[model samples]
Target: MTDEQIREYFEKVDKNINESGYHLTNVFATAETPSFCYSTGIFKSFNIPEIFISSLPPGLCSEIIENYVEAFKESKEAKRNQRLDFLTERFPVYLIDVPVPSLKEYVLSSIKIYGDEEYKYLQVIYPDTKGNFPNDAGYDYDQEIMGEFNN
Candidate 1:
């Protein structure tokens, strides 16, 4: 999108954040990447790291993220590299730190909307059908689904 379009989009996102304490942004998958969704105001509202989830449908991502935000508001903060069983029962999910480099690539929208301030983020990593994470011994799912965070 053009710069102007992006600006307008974030203006709306800012309004949403102001009204509801957060906004969810979903980026559809391309041939070389997987679908992803992230929250934009968790840090601002709860003074905690914002959440990101990849390789999930937009609706499911929204559900999981919303649940996470609610839990966080209740003082249940998810720690880095910890398994988060409360978000899902189908398979456990882990929260990994999203490094500065990966943040520029994956969660740019959040950066753009929130400005150049240092923002902490935790990626929600879900396992494959056999319960294997991207870093597991027998992870069979496409690694792209986890984005570049693992690298």
Candidate 2:
């Protein structure tokens, strides 16, 4: 997408969030090019994901979380397990208490493999496993990563 289109896309997203009175600053994923990415935010406290479904614009919450919803839906275990009933209902809750590396790998791999030009301007929506990120190094590294995708 051209720079103007990208700018317009973000403007719309900002307008939506701004109307809600709570803006999420740190949630988004990049697909392929650095020129644009899917951006959205989730509220988490103490590493637990929270969803105020009513606060999200109509259908926007589902669009942002379709990936995780589908993954759980397709899982046989997730279906049979009574414990996962809440997830099956599509409530916004954090299910992964374990923070395994494979889970992280799966998420990152999914984005890398599926991201494409058609999704260049899609607005969308991770937490760190490690305890408090280092002050200087973590901030610098995050800036570096953001820079890589902000071009």
Candidate 3:
């Protein structure tokens, strides 16, 4: 994007962040990558790790992230490695720590918006219909759809 476009986009995001507590960014899928969505201002507003989810439609991802943020705000107990069964009825989702190396590649907008300061992030991952995660045997989903989770 051009500098002017980037500035306008950031301004819009800032406006949303000011109106609500956060702004959700939905990235459309490309031929080589699956769709993903993330939240900006979660950490700045709640002191919690920002949320990220992949391989899901933008609407569903937005719902999950918004709900998760609400839950975290109410209880302040959500954290990495936690299994959240309430996000989806079809399957439970796991929150994994997003490695530093992956942040630049995936959550660059958040990085820029947050002034490139240190902040935490958690990746929401769900298993296939068989209830098997990426590293588990019998997992049937395409691994590329979820991107790389070094953690």
Candidate 4:
């Protein structure tokens, strides 16, 4: 498919998430393109982009709806500009959420709970096992395996 067609395919995902009350706001997805591609590939395996629903805080939901509603309320020309801004600007990406969701509990899950006191919360949702990530890099490089020629 042409780039436009490929882009068109991604549009469905955007539309579904938007309509589902999911905004694009969360910790930035800094996963390398290769790892991201790999993870998204795993997500696809679980029929998530279609069946996997997420959860959202009510406040965030209202914020997203207000912004979307305000944008669409503008006059035709303004509407076009608003849409352009949304698509072109790097807006915060909030994962779309399903009303009530359940996660298969894991010992070390993606949803890490961290806080001092009072302000505690479950983390952003995550995909299953194949999508699991390690805590830190532990591998050591061998100089014999990588000479200047490796570069």
Candidate 5:
């Protein structure tokens, strides 16, 4: 989809969530575990840092993974540059990151796109953060990794 289409899609989703009174991030939720993430860089174009890392041509995931793992833990300004460096090494036919709302939806979308009659390879990794939401999410941010910050 073009950038305009993407924007429209997001706007629709945003409106639905607002009317439903759900968290903006919860746009991905549907029943079961709503906290899963999917790698769609192989399918279509989307934007995010991960899109670049996951969509490499071939034999590049290993190198990308090594560099990306480091990026997550690094603090230097150079880390972002390194992230971009490893990502552009192999451009998937498409983009970098695509966020789906749930595990089932993510899987179904992939199957529809990549199955024999139907499943393509989509890798999903769900990260769990063991912290409660701040009393005021409207504050714009939260604690980092550990400790307790009120944002």
Candidate 6:
């Protein structure tokens, strides 16, 4: 799709979500690929971020709005839930942090698995600091085997 077409489709999803009474906090589109991601927060608050990523090559653009609408409907039904639960239930999201201030090594090491034949895309949604990666996310970031289940 052309840039204009991509913009139009994203706007359609945004309109649909806004009409449903939820506020969209951010939408990030990649210029290199036909992929776009968006996050929704409760009543315009940014404390909670529920992200959705879609890869709309060319023909699949038609379902963008429908997908967003369905997600919005489901989210409304499961109101005030944990974003971590919502994400991990659908995707293989995990936490990895090497102790002794070498987290960069661990993150890069795990990201290597994304290049393997099985995984098509890898989306890492991290906050500004390591301290911000949600404490109650079931595991401590300081300990864990990197890429154990991700690969």
User: What is candidate 4's TM-score against the reference?
Assistant: 0.20
Q: Please, what is the whole-model Cα lDDT of each candidate in the order they appear?
A: 0.76, 0.29, 0.76, 0.26, 0.30, 0.32
TM-score list, all predictions: 0.83, 0.27, 0.86, 0.20, 0.23, 0.24
For model 1, residues 10-99, the per-residue Cα lDDT tens digits are 898889899988889898889878787888988887777888777788887877877778777767466656677887656677777776
**Cα lDDT of model 5 by residue, 1-151, tens digit:** 8989867755664454345321111123345433332333232221122212211223443444334435432442222211133433443111222233223443443343334531122231211233223333342322111112222
Backbone clashes per model, in order? 0, 2, 0, 9, 6, 0
Q: Which residue pairs show backbone clashes in model 2? A: 39-124, 40-124
* lDDT by residue (tens digit), candidate 3, 1-151: 9999999999998998888878899888888777788889888887778888877778888878887887787666675566678876667887877765575777777888887577777888888778888777788865343334432
For lDDT, the strongest prediction is: 3
**Candidate 6 residues 37-72, lDDT tens each?**
323322232222232333322222223323433544
For residue 95, model 5's alpha carbon misses the true position, in angstroms, by 19
TM-score preference between candidates 5 and 6, better one? 6
| Candidate 3 regions with alpha-carbon error over 4 angstroms | 143-151
C-alpha RMSD (angstroms) for model 4: 20.0
Find the candidate with the highest TM-score and give its number.
3
**Root mean square deviation (Cα) for candidate 3:** 2.6
Clashing pairs in 1: none
RMSD of each: 2.9, 16.4, 2.6, 20.0, 15.8, 14.6
Ranking by lDDT, best first?
3, 1, 6, 5, 2, 4
Q: Candidate 4: deviation at residue 75, Å?
A: 4.0
| Cα deviation of 109, candidate 3, in Å | 1.3
Q: Residue 46 of model 3: what lDDT?
A: 78
Q: Order candidates by TM-score, high to low.
A: 3, 1, 2, 6, 5, 4
